[model samples]
Target: MASTKKTTAAKVQAPIDNRETFVSLQKSFADSDMPVEEKLKTLYQLQAADSEIDKIIQLRGELPAEVAALEEEIADLKERSAAISAVIDQLNRNIADAKLAIAEHESIIEKYQRQLETISNSREYDSLNKEIENQELLRQIGEKTINDTRMEISSKKSELEDLKDRLSIRTEDLAAKKTELENIVEETAKEEAVLRERREECAAKIDARTMSAYERIRASVHNRLAVVGIYNGDSCGGCFNTITPQRRVEIVSNKKLIICEHCGRIIINPDFAQ
Candidate 1:
């Protein structure tokens, strides 16, 4: 293993430019004494380890993602259920207040009617009748408020029930998916753990800029191969594109780091794969 350096590339290059540095990442470690072939070996080893881990992850067959989605849905439903509960509680309070207002209005109306019977003058009788009429209007308004609030509460409760039902289904789904995932993980756990450890060890040998470039390439490609050997003796292994004769000679020389111009994957000489 080579001593890893955290130095940046050339002063002209960004500290870590995945796009441009990918072509000639060796410049990022201009001061390193390790040969290019040795660096490519470490990078290839890292790719192998990652590929193995990817296969292990495939064994789970989307169970992990399903579990994650279910959990997210359950969380959202719980939040909505809580909000609906709060709204229902508020509406109940409104109904309670409306009922109280209706009771007060009824009492006032009763008192005004009694006063109307004892009034001796026409002016007094008119005033008592006016007070009674005002009280009746207020009572009707309070009853209408109570009716509207109850209807709203009923709607909110129905929404809450739907949310609860959905939450229950999602919770069950998450549990089942989690169990399946746990079983798959249990089977591959040992192999995956060892491969991951090897991957870290191999990655540590390479310089920072090369590692950054390799990671970016892996993420962009479907196969996740960032370092590949010469394919069928004269093609880019990653994309199967024909390599120029002159470039293939340089790649075989291994004096300088080489990459495929078409696919941008680091090209290791086929001889090295031996």
Candidate 2:
């Protein structure tokens, strides 16, 4: 009997048509009516604008306190100056009163001198002389009081002048700063508009799900990158995390969408050199 040879067929696993799947998904994404990427880009533009607005608001918020503090300081100085002015006014009144006293004393002195001519006896002459002596003493006191008030007025005026100068300088500085901030806000407006336009274009290209994922991850990630290419044996280009062999094989196959487990980014493996 001839020896019978048993032939066993090798089992062949069905090949997953990943390229076709990728191509189909690509076409579907490209043909979709909704400009997903543009929407996403618009969202980004809005977010950036909001961020800038927040910064401006924060700066503006801080400015009020600084301005208020400066204003308060100036107000206090004004109050002090007013008080000084009141004191000066009081001193002036005192000086005027002293001058009036001096004038009255001079009048009394003149009357006493005139009465000396009309005195009937030695007793009356002596009495008139004593009255003249009292008036002269009072006049000397009034003159001294006026001199002291004049000195006080001069000192107060000098101090008030310095405070006014300082207040004027401070007001000018605060005004300049406020103008600068306003100018900066105006300048940023055009830049913000351009950024918004660019972001809208970006949104039109990306799909809704992908865009959402990108935005969510972008928020969580410090680098603000949601998509990344794989390089150097399944290493993440964004964070440089070495991917597992299974994940690398899956990414290379491009069968379905795959994300980097570590960084949560869509991974794209470059074609190996043929």
Candidate 3:
């Protein structure tokens, strides 16, 4: 039997400094005397801590995102209101200029009418008459411009009022959402801190390679499970796949690391599942 001589040679493992290279950490965990059961327990504990933190975050729901959206809407409404106010201001200036032009036209019409009274011949009378008619037409055009500009300004002011009302509503919504989110965060802050500290302690006991594997599995899966136990005495706890008798014996022994072929999660003894 060639397999009879197989023996694991013990290598000198340096103390874990928490700064070992990635490959070195793997070697260190292998050479150390720590039991495989303890390593599995540490991994399970870490997962539990992380899951609790996830639950705390879930308690906040969508309040944070709702607050941000409301703030953005309020800002957009305020910007629109500012643009409309600028447009109305320009319209008022236009009205002022139109009034000045109307006054000039009226002055010219009056001067032409006075000249008509002193005209000596038919040619002078015709020139003065034509000049008065042209000035009267120009004055009417200026009046129309003033009236149209006033109407536009009135319309823009109404739109501005609507925009202001919308901005006010959005602002109030943002404030309420912010208060709700803050309350949730405040309520969970202390519990989350304690859980995170426990998480760090459990993580420190795990080798870097195994920790990396756990993180990768958690990220890839929807439920974030990286360590699980046996279920129903015959199934993988994480994936619910049926486990053969031979594989179940190996996992129960807890002498070697066991990974679920179906889900790639570390399988442990069923006692941890409780």
Task: State in Å the error of residue 50, model 1.
Answer: 4.3
lDDT of 1 at 49: 92
lDDT of 3 by residue, 101-152 (tens): 9999999888888888888899889988888888899899999999899889
TM-scores for the candidates: 0.59, 0.53, 0.72
Instruction: Pull out the clashing pairs in model 1.
Output: none
Higher-ranked by lDDT: 2 or 3: 3
Candidate 1: segments with Cα more than 4 A from true spot: 1-50, 57-72, 193-222, 226-234, 243-274
In TM-score terms, candidate 1 sits at: 0.59
Model 1 scores what on Cα lDDT?
Answer: 0.79
lDDT tens digits by residue: candidate 2, 132-245:
999999999999999988998999999999988988988887897777767766876676566666666666566665566556655555444455557776697556779888
| Best-performing candidate as measured by TM-score | 3
Candidate 2: where are CA atoms >4 Å away? Answer: 1-51, 191-274
The digit string of per-residue lDDT tens for model 1 on 145-248 reads: 88888889999989999999888888888888898899889978998999999999988888877788788777666567778888888899977889999999
**Candidate 3: which stretches are off by over 4 Å?**
1-41, 55-70, 205-209, 219-223, 229-242, 245-256, 269-273
lDDT of each: 0.79, 0.66, 0.78
Prediction 3 TM-score vs. true: 0.72
